[model samples]
Target: MSASVPTVGSWHRLDRAGLQAVIDVLWLVGHRVVGPQVADGAIVIRDLRGVAELPTGWLDDQDGGSYRLRHDPVAGTFDHVVGPHSLKNFLFPARETIASFVQLNGSWSQTPPPAQVPPLAVLGVRGCDLAALAIQDRVFLGSGYVDEPYKSRREKLFLVAVNCRRAAATCFCHSMGSGPAAGPGFDLALTEIEGGFACEVGSERGAAVLAEAVAAGASIGGCSPEEVEAARGVPQALAARMHARQQGDGEPRPRSLDTHGIRDLLMTNLEHPRWDEVAARCLSCTNCTLVCPTCFCSSVQEVADLSGDHVDRERQWASCFSLDHARMHGHSVRSSTAARYRQWLTHKFAGWIDQFDTSGCTGCGRCITWCPVGIDVTEEIAAIRASGSGAAPPDGAAPAGAPEAGETAS
Candidate 1:
């Protein structure tokens, strides 16, 4: 069916089959489509061959240190929130070889591998992850030193973002001012309704693909007024539902930490007792940082063959929870879990703003959902804030053995 041409930001309805056609068009154009699929009992992001790869009829239940996938035939393909993976894995892989060296004639010869960058179309990306992407861009691109590998992958990326229709128990993106709704930085944004998707194009590349889909008769032109209204209402309805859920049993609705004063709140509470309380439960397993989309810590290692004829230098994902992460000479700076945890929280919430002009956390809540000990960052911040004027240090004197304020041992 031929439909009216869609203007930028206007909604266009595409049925399930039409969505498949859209994917086909992208693949034909040499874009590797990456999307969510069920793997090992959880929704995982991977290279997709077709629409059949999506986790259709599956929804996730997430809470602190917990996640379970359930079959709900009525749920849309994009119904689930987030999984253990994020866009970071694609743009910034867990392990990468920076360079390789070989001993030739008793002399070392170094060779930098050619860059392997692929054009990518990421389907079903959520808004909070988009926000996380933006923060990462600042870190990798906007910073003084540019990560060439990250830049190469990002330059060819095409984003198909999905606005959230339902909030997970661990989600607080709305509180972080990131989403429940799709925002900027996407090529196409989708809101799934009954039997179709309400799509909006955000870039020239998005517009081109959408036009191709329409020309091929994969999409019906012009969304109805009611459909448009419903598409716009998706995030609003999610927000209301989240509010109601938080206010269970007439209790006060859980509010996000006041980010405006968070820097001061954490800076002033360096010696707070809550750190000890949380450290007791923290395993220092680094699950929280690994699952976090914005945590970009990494370490480099050199591997050599048995004959020592060749060596490869690799960059691997690292976490603040690791003792080696804070090691200096013969001593570890953050000897206790308390110091490491404190460093992570303060860096994400406070130091990040100073360095990047934005918070490192997008509030996707994966850190909470995947944490083995169920350590909630929101609750931790709340506890420290509730304890006002905690053991104030003397003027011009730092806490006895505490690292300097805003100093990250990791």
Candidate 2:
């Protein structure tokens, strides 16, 4: 596949087959293409061999603590919004072996694991997740101490972002200023319409991939002006439909959070009683952090062979909800569920700003949709604000006898 120089800012139209052609070109260039697919009764990001693997014509119904996959053959393949998984799962694996050890003659030696980084091309990356990726990049790359594994994988990643046509019931990216439209950091972006994809290139790699697709006859040509106009209008139309859905009775909904002030709001309300109220409902199952695309807390575990001759040290995802997470000098600082939940919320919305110069949340709403108890962060913040309790309490001021927060009820 070949083509002349592509116009940098132009939008091109690639039909369904043209989209598949791009995937094929990616495979030819040694990229392990991954995208959204129907699996385990939900749309999930996974390794895809071809375009047929996409969850085409499937729509997802997501709300607090609930999700249902419905078939809508009439709808485009990219119609649904995000799912349980995020780009982090692939970039920063949940559990990974960092080192291995061998024991001989009562002496042990450690060696770093072999690098297994592979080229990856991710399709259908949502805007919020892209923002989260940038946050993760800051944590693992921008920070003075770099995560080598993350850097290796990140260097090889090729991102193809997609703008959302419709907002999920739990979505609040608009409030967070993270997305609805693809933002910076992607290689290529796509907006799906009735006949084909309206594509934009964000990098040289994206241009190369798109040129290959065009050369292979995957795209007819540059998008027509009318098609470009239509593509630009899809998001607005979807936003209106979402508004109607959210305001079924034509009643006004609560105003969105003033995210600009969220840092101060959370920092000042450290001892708000609303924390207790939310703690009552929060399972502390760590679903929020797990589903979160930017939560990077982890713990190291050591494993030994049955013969005790070999050992491996692995890094696994950890959650603040766990009692051991706050253990210090034989005492848990956040002994109460309220305190643990407070730590998570504060760290995400407040402390992160001080630490990373950015908010931890991208407002994808995965936490609300996947929580077993349906604990909504936006609602919790609203409740705290409504209480009008912004004064910070003295140290160690959490209420007594509060239940411990974990995956299960105490």
Candidate 3:
């Protein structure tokens, strides 16, 4: 049978059991279905065979430098917010051999790696992550230089987005205009309701895959009036709940970021004292960049076999926090941790606009939760914005207490 396409804006209903059929359809189509599950006390996305693998009945408590998972038997599978994983890690793997060289008769022959990226079906995506994907698309696809590897893998992938019904203490995607509700760039988007899921088809493939699931005996049909209203209220309800928590006096609520004049705000505050203060707490561990959904910092290296006849060029994920990331002529320009932190922060919020016309951050808050010392980007940016000196420090103005020349900083 030919693929069936549902109306783009139409709403549908799917009982909780139908969720497993959705996974079965993807598996039947030879897709390696992946979804979130409880792993090591955190929600992590990994290859999954069925709905039983999902992190159902799990709730996450997220805050600066902390992530803890608790259980509530009645909760939805995707109640957790952004984890350490994102679509970026799947599309752009941590390591890949882009090119290889072999020597024949003392001459080298360069060959590109064969493209064999598997078709992937990723479920339980969030709106902030979808927003991050667009930013990455701008960097790797829309930028003047196209990344072939990224393009090839992206073309063969399927994405299922889930609207966020709850926000983590560290979450600020709503302030970034990215989440609390799943947005575009998904094949299928699901809003979990009391009885089941309210489904929205964002792409023809989404509809076709869902239709396949139905044909395979999955339950799917028109939503009742109440279900439709509940579906529509997902985002608004989450927003109001987050607002109430933030307004209440107690533990920190979902974070909020003021992006007004943000680019100019970061650019003009190059010499803010906050950088030094934060640097005191920063371990320069690269946790923030690694966990960030949109940060694409990486480095390429050449490896050679013992025979010296075979060589391969490999690309590895890198971080600006590394002392060697800014190395030039045997010295790192951003030698101090404070300098490196400044570079990362400015580039994430300011220089990114210049490069990709979008902020490198999606307000996912993985950086905050994963940071060992809990260096919250939102808090840091807020401090700078509040206390920025308003003067553009001269070029190469080292951060406060920066190591002197020829001194190495950890």
Candidate 4:
């Protein structure tokens, strides 16, 4: 058992026993282990009893408007891509109560919830999702907001990031300049090699796990230099194949729209023709921002028992696509679909950088794939740019596009 930090030298190969041994040790340390397992016709995160419970041979297929589960057949011998759910659920959960207030005998008092049990190990997180977590760290932790729940969950997390051996059609982390390999931010990274798993320790917790598992001989053994290169080459090869098939050429760089002018553009385009086009297809489902790791918007709800003896205030996820999200004094600022859509798009690609000094979009493409109506964000941006340049909407087309949305444009 060897321990090293984020660099490549810290890598070791772990056989099945070694992997299981590490899981056992982490569990002993009071860490709740979570990973993808096959359930309900899809791969979802759940508690793992051992390596066997983790999804083996399970893979997912995603596109602009589709998702499906497929069997890899290779089973344990694969590095699966990140599933629809990322580590955010564990950290910034879908909803949580901060505290509750109660009135008793004409006196008001507050009851605070107990601290959360830190989820110890999150196994099989992909590199892109790892990057997304990093981005969220900047949003929730680094920001002055200091989301208390997110901070608590992050402090206890033991990340096990995996490189992408394959990418779904909708995946574009490579284009967004985020993935193909585990960069920084994970406690450990695993790459599926020929016979076992190539593991790299990225933190002290990861090193301790490696140390506990070493007596079991899960570490990689004598391999020709070529074999090591071959094992490491898998992710890069997979990335290249994905790039070849994607619609656009090279990386889909974030569109460098005029930042100085964007606020005015968004402010002015409230009633633009594109709004009507997009509204037709946008079910007003908040899937895009919901799946977006950087989207930190949330709403609070309070629950109380009939006795009024106990009450709880819960903060849950919110979406810009929802009418109530922008509501003020019984009216929403972005009341219409066109206004809401434009607000989200401009904020993501344009104003986010101006406000945060970093691009909000990592281009994970979750929005493109999860949308039930198949609204392509990239295509919409292209359409907006076209409309701005005096290219009229396609022969009575809606703001988003034609009534029929295509797979993805080149």
Candidate 2 per-residue lDDT over residues 199-252, each given as its tens digit: 877888889888887787764467667877888777667655654554464222
* Ten residues in sequence with the least summed lDDT for candidate 1: 401-410
Q: Which stretches of candidate 4 lie over 4 Å from their true place?
A: 1-9, 75-79, 215-228, 247-272, 385-410
In candidate 1, position 162 carries an lDDT of 93
- Per-residue error for 183 in candidate 1, Å, reads 1.3
Error of 2 at 218 (Å): 2.8
- Regarding TM-score, does 3 or 4 come out ahead? 3
Report the CA-based lDDT of candidate 3 relative to the real structure: 0.81
Q: Per-residue lDDT of 247-279 in model 1, one digit per residue for the tens? A: 574222233434445666687787888989999
Best TM-score goes to which candidate? 3
Ranking by TM-score: 3, 1, 2, 4
Q: What TM-score, to 2 decimals, does candidate 4 have?
A: 0.83
Off by over 4 Å in 2: 1-7, 236-255, 391-410
Distance from true location, Cα of 356 in model 1, Å: 0.8
Q: Estimate the TM-score for candidate 2.
A: 0.89
Best-to-worst ranking by lDDT: 1, 3, 2, 4
Model 3 weakest lDDT span, ten residues long: 401-410
